[model samples]
Target: MSKILNEFLSSNLQELKDNGLYNEINVVRGANGPVIDIDGKELINLSSNNYLGLATDETLKQAAKDTIDSHGVGAGAVRTINGTLDVHVELEETLAEFKGTEAAVAFQSGFNCNMAAIQAVMNKEDAILSDELNHASIIDGCRLSRAKIIRVNHSDMDDLRQKAKEATESGQYKKVMYITDGVFSMDGDVAKLPEIVEIAKEFDLITYVDDAHGSGVMGKGAGTVKHFGLEKEVDIQMGTLSKAIGVVGGYIAGTKELADYLKVAARPFLFSTSLTPGDTKAINEAVKMLMASTELHDQLWENGDYLKKGLKSLGFNIGNSETPITPCIIGDEKTTQAFSKRLMEEGVYAKSIVFPTVPRGTGRVRNMPTAAHTKEMLDEALEIYEKVGKELNVIS
Candidate 1:
């Protein structure tokens, strides 16, 4: 490697370490579940996004195995080419039905979906009104679109309405779009979708919602759009198969015309390889499970409530979360990370979120409670949390 590049890497990494922003990745010995083993120690895991716990479900595992046996390991080509298999078509169909949309299209990952979807629909002449706290993928997507992006305050309906009205009335752009997260990941808050849709209608702006964290967790697992009964009204709905779906991919659900347009216009779908057969099969089965019953969904919320109540009872600031995602706010970055480290030492695996991932000085330890966690497991985790919180002076 060049000397200049080596020096650049070393300096940047050192800077991260000095600022307490460096992440030390823990290796999981096996499948990610409610309980995970790390470096010879088994811990109660509360850091995963496996809300419904289908990641290691027997049915999904079998579906993946069967697909691999029949279709081999790879998709063979990009989606625009021969990579589009019957299983892929079936998955899209299932997604469309599950989302209550006219059609849908899948991508290699949620990030790719955002990149492709935004650029496909918007260009230099368009304007995008995006939520300030939307996912990094959405921010990157807006940047990639080359459209003028106006950031609206997080979940501030008045800000969104004002921005939407201004963007539309200015008449400087061919089209205006408002994009937001259906569920804010860090804070565990649901987006104001109903109000957003109403504003979009009043301003005649295109509406998009990234429901990555909402799918399989809200509206009996149909997601936040359906939770607010705006499935048919929102112009574009994007979701991930990786999170609650317990598989790995992302998709855009919309009208048949939008799907058709994206098929030809989305560069990532045209250029990158499609999802593997096993993943597609597992995703399809996961969606089927969500459509079949609400048992897992209910359990996930129960676990979330249990953990949240336990943390709050201990005097930890859990924040205002409306979903299963819980955050134990610690305020200071180093203290927050130290709190997480102490929890791991006490046999609970949770991670700390700080500056960049969240606003500075508002550090938090985010906990994800899944359906797979047993009552016994949660009880043990809570006990560890209590001990660690008290020891760290995060709780009395």
Candidate 2:
């Protein structure tokens, strides 16, 4: 708009382009299932977070459509302003039951859930000990809380223990909290919850675990907190209905007092419009599915293992991943982007992660294998991977 603003944007744009950091957005034309259509080409979609492939499930779709018929569309107002629908109450109850918590409160999205819950609990007089590799939402939440942030090494229990001990012994804050992702998204590593819980017990620090990527993928789909049997120990359990739940919302599961406090004090909950009735109903159905069976979860893991083995056999570095998320480490940013482009040309759509999304020189092509993927589909994708890997010199 303004000349100065235009110049500023141009400068940054040129810098990104010169450094091979600029990214081009692609239009996904069809449903984001195990396979997706991008630019009129079908591809084995390996870039989605839909771990269980429930996003397009008939059950969830029907539930959403049925709810829409009964409750119209939007929530009309914020939760505090008479916008809380019966579906919202039902979803919250379902979430609480799923997470084995006394109460649960839902938000518009996972990012906002972190922003709301963290600030509602921690304050200026408090201190936070966080994992270095925690999700961006956790970082923003800690920052929003205005707590003295102390970053511990990623998944390093020793560092966490030391920091927790120091923060508590200093007596410089009224309260201290240790926060981490239940599963690190990029690297596909699980958090050391058992050790973290022990440290929290020792220091009496409030515990927070953001299970955005862990819900419906861990604990037979209950989440990482349940995976580690720390359901009651972890003070705050944050998760998303967007990922594995195949809906659009986030929630905080904890004690009744904590949920009550968030409902009253969290700015997003108090000011933002509540989730749609369709989303609420769909998420309730998703949770019920997970509670009833583990078919999808098992299928997802099998697909992940198959893809990882296939990639590894082709001489591509799949990185150290213990979950369904697989990353083919390509190192340089340009090479990573180029490889992703080549894969797209071959009708395999996998996104490249570089720089800001990951650390420098650690760029990768992350793959998410969902339950809906058939064995034949994965085998075909692996053949494409082999061709691309060889062409790009990523494999011999």
Candidate 3:
């Protein structure tokens, strides 16, 4: 490599190491379940996004296996060309129904949905009022759209209203839109969608919700929008098939017009290879299961409440999360990393998250208690947490 490139890489790498911002990847030896094997050690896994534990469901697995045998693996090409398989059409239909929308379009991944849908709708001539703490995918999608982005404070309806008024009345843009995550992953706070929709109605602004972390976790598995009964009010709803759906892909659910427009305009759907048949089939089955019952969803909440109560009682700052995603806040970055390391050593596998993912000095070890996690597993994990916390002087 050239001298400049080497210097740039060396300095950045050293800085991350010095600041406790460097992420160490752990390899899961088997299926990512409530308990996972890492480095020959059995650990109570609390770092996954599998809220309902459908990722390892035998039903989903069987669906994928069956489809792979019948349709082969890949979708063969991009959807616009020849990849619009029968399963693809079926999955989108299921997704649209799940979202309570008129139509839906699937993408290869959740990240791609934002990258495609945002730019396809908004442009430089428009302005996007986004939540200050939205996922990075939303941030990047806004930038790619070339729209004037105005940041609204986290869940602050007043701030959203003020920004909405300014953007819509400024006359500096042709159209304005408000976008936010249905659930903020880091803090696990639900967005104030009702108030946001009210504001949008007042200003005639478009509304979009990136429900990547909410689907199958909120709205009795329908999503946050449905959770609030705003399915018909919200214009665009984007969700992941991977997270709670327990598969691999994303979708944009909205009116038939929006879906039709995106089918023609979204570059990722035009260029990238489509989601494989197996994943599509599996995702379809998963959604169907959720519609059939809320057994997993109820169990997930039970585990989350148990874990949060345990941590809070132990004197850890378990933030004001309203979802199964819990964060044990340890302010200092280095200490947070050390805390997580100690937890790992004691048989729990919660990982530390620091700068960039969350604000500086608010580093945390995010714990995801899923439906697959038993009361016994949570009790064991909590016990380990208490021991680690006291040992590390994180709790009295």
Higher-scoring candidate on lDDT, 1 or 2: 1
lDDT of 2 by residue, 33-121 (tens): 98898877899899999899889999999999999999988888999888999999999999999999999999999999999999988
Which regions of candidate 1 fall more than 4 Å away from where they truly are? none
Q: Write the per-residue lDDT of candidate 1 for residues 34-122, one digit (tens) a residue.
A: 99999999999999998899999999999999999999999999988799999999999999999999999999999999999999999
Global lDDT of model 1: 0.93
Report how far residue 389 has shifted in candidate 3, in Å: 0.7
Candidate 2 ranges beyond 4 A from true positions: none
RMSD of candidate 1 to the true fold? 0.8
Sorted by lDDT, highest first, which candidate order results?
3, 1, 2
TM-score of 1: 0.99
TM for every model, in the order presented, reads 0.99, 0.99, 0.99
- Specify the poorest-scoring 10-residue window by lDDT in model 2: 30-39
lDDT of 2: 0.92
